[model samples]
Target: MTGASPLRPDEAALREAIVHTAREMERLGINQGTSGNVSARCADGLLITPSGVPATALHEDAIVWLPLDVAADAPVLSERKPSSEWRMHRDILRARPELNAVVHTHSVAATAMAIHSRDIPAHHYMVAVAGGNSIRCAPYATFGSQALSDYAVAALQERYACLLAHHGVIAASATLSRALWIANEVEVLAKQYLLASQLGTPPLLSDDEMAEVLEKFRNYGMRGTSGNGAH
Candidate 1:
């Protein structure tokens, strides 16, 4: 079963969400031009951002739809080329079945942190958005290649998000909206960490403390807590 049986009716909603999120990223200065791509798994196929298209100019029909199954060297749904990083997107979906949405961004801070010698420590609880610890950066790989896809899959093991060294950040979630939110949160946290480090050795949370917060987060609903306890 292709993840909820391809909601054709939901395609409009999905397209709108992708367009809005891409525009939002540009507005927030997280993505520039058409440097990043986003995708959401649908029952019919995967809905992905078309390559070389500016976020501001993306229309609903401009979004490319690729079938979950590869058929005769083409996607069953359309003839258009998928994202340049389609393999990475496909691998992420294959590895994390629960993840319905994936957001990849070329944000400055996160990309900078990805190339750093040290891992990003859990300095704040917001890191829980990335599986409740710290985001791991996958080793550097040539973009748009199987090596990069494999590296991303490895880094995403047991985590909801990962950074691509010298490239960008990738975040996945059960929903497209949540994935976008988490991606934004990651960039924010990365920027904060970068700034703090410039101030001469930022304080990091201890392992025990991070574990405690992660446990608490699990009880509070691992996704996130709403204003009410309904989460």
Candidate 2:
């Protein structure tokens, strides 16, 4: 997901991207087993990983498609069940019209921070990569619940990623690769923050400093990349 290149847009290609990303997340150690899910915006809806399926067992045809307009509780027509987090993904893409992909992970360090309900503050200027001075942690809610989806959408306001209290991390972006990249970056930041806290509290960048960083980030990092797929 780290800016290798933009993916091709055809449904066939996007399906492959979903499978590739799911496995890559596991391979990169950001996710394990069936704990994480991936999705991409497609015509009128989204293509998502299937529920209860490990990335190692996932295949392109196992991917599920759901219309964005459907209620989270509604039955889906696909042969396979979409990820339990489909509601969160659907709400995010619907709310953030510009974002085309979503990656959810139970990465160890990030979820460790989330278990404490801590936000990732601007302990590093790279915090701006998430489109904010901090990565907010949404209040705890049962997985797959509509309440959880609501909190996640609000926490992600003006940001590409957020942590779920007692749950995991969610990273969304304009493309599948960028979403995967942001998901990885969130884990890195969380790990650094935890390491720094061992010294009795990490120094934080001032709001003014973070503002400057955010300004510089507007024309840099993942946002600066340009390509044809998932603009």
Candidate 3:
């Protein structure tokens, strides 16, 4: 038989962070009622937002905890169902062991950019927040499906964030709060790019310049700071 999984004291902390950040996202207009979900890795499993539940109403106990090793047929942790996109969270955690948190949201600017025919360029230094050189958008796929998960994983290659075509954005990080911070920064950048593009052609940083910025990100004080800059 498989060994019993260990418990995680950090699970409660993660749950609270998810709820709090989800509300923040809503307040900032990054997410709407019941439209976004956040997940974080726990020692034994995962903590995730419940489906069809608004961020404004989330409670700690209301969050769902799914055992990582549980049989697919086994009962889930809460009476409230887990997010339909749990599969995406599962795949990301399985593929990127270093990532502790995953956030998916339908923020306006990011989603608008995702619908464009091209990738979101790293024209600015802040692009490093999402990892690698640029933010990529995965091809459109039905939400909550394996196809979507596969596309997201593929787009996330060597990157911490990706835009879901016709859908939203996904960002992962080493901590729950950091993940949320990156997601927020991505939206802000998207908004800037949109406005800049309308004002005329936006100057884009060259590949070498972006590389330098990414290198700097490794030592940047903001790299892992969280909770509205509380650090």
Candidate 4:
């Protein structure tokens, strides 16, 4: 608890969700220590987990409040320093209005694939969950730079998830849970792809096949939405 005083009830709840999402990432083994970050849109900005702080030790007020237009040197404005990847989170949240939550993780399998600069092909139907036939791997960049954020935005084209080369995985969605779910699913796909590679290249589904699956997802996949299923 620090500067800028208190949070409204809903904002407080969102902070709690951010913390819970971060903790869940570790428990699911998709993240470790302070290796990942989580955030959700609020008011005119986003509430992101602070830098180098373990999720289990996070408290609501310790979350960093980054205005969408926060200046580069204004990290001091927030009570705590935002995550080192704050640039990526800020860029994604600002660029994708439909996505309210963003989660970045160094999940083992996903990062392993990223290190190889391998994109996950549509070898599985669930690959369409990311809104494409494949999950892309962004080119490598310094961890906390605008260059990394630029690469991430490009790689996430038409998709909710992407792999950061030599770094980790990142996913953004309309909700905290959905973003985390997408990250987890990305890791699963990465693991499957790696295992299958050992037995020779996996047969990829055709474009038409993925198209049909995407259409079905648009119709009945979501409880009450369009093309918004978990897949």
Candidate 5:
């Protein structure tokens, strides 16, 4: 069911955060117009950005509350419709309880790489922060379709970020800011990868080395709160 109730104090704050994040994405230049969406987990559902709304026009009340258990294609009851990618956000939050926020972007570089269906390997050690040595690209599926949501869930199985083939990027984390950070980082990585390709194949970190980095990230904290290794 789409939750249309008045927001509780905490829910209100969460809704505001989602609106802020949706705008932040635009300011960061990782998203444009209304091509991306942001959401934060709330009481039995998620507060997602409204469909087709530009960031400048977004507001707390415009956020749509979608229950985690509702069917992906179920008719929404809210005054505003949730983003078309709401199912992807909902499924990820349901499958990864540790993650509370999800950011989906059509960032240029990342989408360029996604259009080619490429994975971002551990060419830089920082890739470990995403919980793996590589950010996989989920095979393409039509936007708003269940198949796309299924593909996203599978690609994010052991990673917090993934590229949707021919589409864009998905970055999810324990907090909205952290998820946004990952989204930006993925775009940076994609840009760097494309630039480095000019010098032939870029040297990649070995699996053993990536494993060590992953361990270190785990110990130092994958979340940005620690401020140790996280960006």
Candidate 6:
């Protein structure tokens, strides 16, 4: 038998954050249908949106909690089935203790580039906000498969965000809001990259230039910083 466990107490706010992020994706045009999912780490496991549930209709209690230490073959610990992409969220949360949340979406421009299996190079300094010189596209795999999860994890090794070739995007951070914000930035960068490509191969930053920006990111980007989110 698999090693799934039970939920813990007072995770009400995390449930709300997941629900809000799901719907926010819709509002922000980062996703459509129920094609995206969000999750936040909790005391016992992680809280995720229910499978196939529309974000507008999502309610806090409908969220599913999967214990961190659970074995893969175990029945899910909650009544509702979790998102099909739960494995990536689960793996990401397990692998990255510094990140408390994960946001995945089939955001338009990003997905368009991913359809070509192209990575977003450092055409703009804002790419550093993802903690990298470029956003790599994890090689394609069937959605919801363990292979896809593995590919995403590897692509995001030193970065908080990455695209899934022909699939979508993934962003994670210390907080749900920050994760969502980064997802939006990735989408904007994707849009920019796509637009610039129409003219010619876009100019890209040198590794040294991107390194300078990555350093700026640690002290910038987040709202409370002196640069006021400029990095």
Query: Model 2: per-residue lDDT, tens digit, 60-132?
Result: 8888888778674455734458898889999999999999999999999999999999999999987878888
Task: Tell me the TM-score of each prediction against the true structure.
Answer: 0.88, 0.91, 0.89, 0.92, 0.94, 0.92
Superposed by TM-score, candidate 4 places the C-alpha of residue 170 at a distance from the truth, in angstroms, of 0.6
Score residue 182 of candidate 6 by CA lDDT. 87
lDDT of 4 by residue, 1-231 (tens): 332423556987898898889999999999998899998888878888889899788887788887777767774545568899888988999898888999999999999989999899999988887888899999999999999999999999788899999999999888888888888989999999989989999999999999888777666553122343454
- Expressed as tens digits, the lDDT of each residue in 1-231 for candidate 3 is 112224576666777888887888898788999998998888757778888899988888767777665443565633447888888888888888888889999999999988873567876777877776689999999988889999999998888899999999999988877887788888988998998899897898888998887776665654554533412
Q: CA lDDT of each candidate?
A: 0.78, 0.86, 0.80, 0.85, 0.87, 0.85
- Please report the TM-score between candidate 1 and the true structure: 0.88
Clashing pairs in 1: 6-43, 6-44
Record all residue pairs in model 4 with backbone atoms less than 3 Å apart, i.e. clashing.
none
User: Model 3 off-target regions past 4 Å?
Assistant: 1-7, 69-74, 77-80, 221-231
lDDT of 2 at 100: 94
lDDT tens per residue, model 1, 84-112? 88878878887778788888999888888
Which of the two candidates, 4 or 6, achieves a greater TM-score against the reference? Answer: 4
Error of 4 at 141 (Å): 0.2
**TM accuracy, model 3:** 0.89
TM-score, cand. 6: 0.92
**lDDT score at residue 119, model 5, on the 0-100 scale:** 95
Candidate 5 C-alpha lDDT tens digits along 151-202: 9999999898999999999999988988988999899889999999889999
